[model samples]
Target: MPTTEITHALLAPGESELIEVAGNRIRIIVANPTLLVCDYSAAPHFPGPPLHVHPGFDETYIVLEGRLEVTVAEERRELAPSAAAYVSGSVPHTFDNPGAERARFLSICSPGGFEDFFRAMATGDREAIVGVSERFGYEAVKTRG
Candidate 1:
């Protein structure tokens, strides 16, 4: 649920809400009406989500450590630390860690509300995840380029 009262939020290290999804540790740093920010670390060569889109919001992936392979439509790029990728909500996209070392990154979603998807994903229930995805306009595409 989106916070009814938007306020400042600060997450120190492990203080955030941490959820393990798809073998990745995702810490939700901030979630409010206007933005949602999460910090996550992906295991080496971890395959990310299938090509997907969240039509309700735009997203940005900012690499904090190691390299993250990001694909937006047909274009793929391996981004190093401090590198970032901005993806429009209508674009089909995905990300993974292609390097041998673990990769850390921040995922920022504007007009926040998608954190519920992560929470639902933490339950490891496919049906629930699908419902939440549908509710949030998050959809995995079969063919996108």
Candidate 2:
């Protein structure tokens, strides 16, 4: 399929989604076989709590707006606008907005398919996330969503 720009309104709106990660509102700005770019909004009212990881794909997060508290492995750091972070495959990572304002960022995942994982989570298809994770060589285990 050709690249598509999917907005947040086009996605299933809620407090939590699988396709977008736990603590953010994700809008797929671009999607194709090679790459997927998502726009994430971490609002102050949103409690960013989900800790998850990717197995096969590496991802880069570029802060477009506010600040965020990012935790990768056991280390935690704060990222400001224009700053970026990278998460390699098999690394456990999570983040939340510590600032009072909304945090916006562009997250690009290489090799694309992780988009489906997020989509499944947003649509309430747990099996799809699990299946996709298994095939991709990583899985997200947590006590809550």
Off by over 4 Å in 1: 1-3, 143-145
Pairing residues by index, what is the TM-score of model 1?
0.89
Lowest lDDT 10-residue stretch of candidate 1: 1-10
Candidate 1 lDDT by residue in tens digits, 1-145:
6546766775678688898877788888998878989898998889788898988899999999999999998999999999999999999899988778899999999988788888888887788778878866888897533
Q: Measure candidate 1: CA RMSD.
A: 2.3
TM-scores for all predictions:
0.89, 0.72
Best by lDDT: 1
Give candidate 2's error at residue 13 in angstroms. Answer: 19
What value does the lDDT take at residue 6 in candidate 2?
44
Clash pairs, model 2 backbone: 18-118, 18-121, 19-118, 19-119
> Per-residue lDDT of 42-144 in model 2, one digit per residue for the tens?
8775656566776778888999998877877778888998999999867887778867888999889887776786788777788997898887776554632
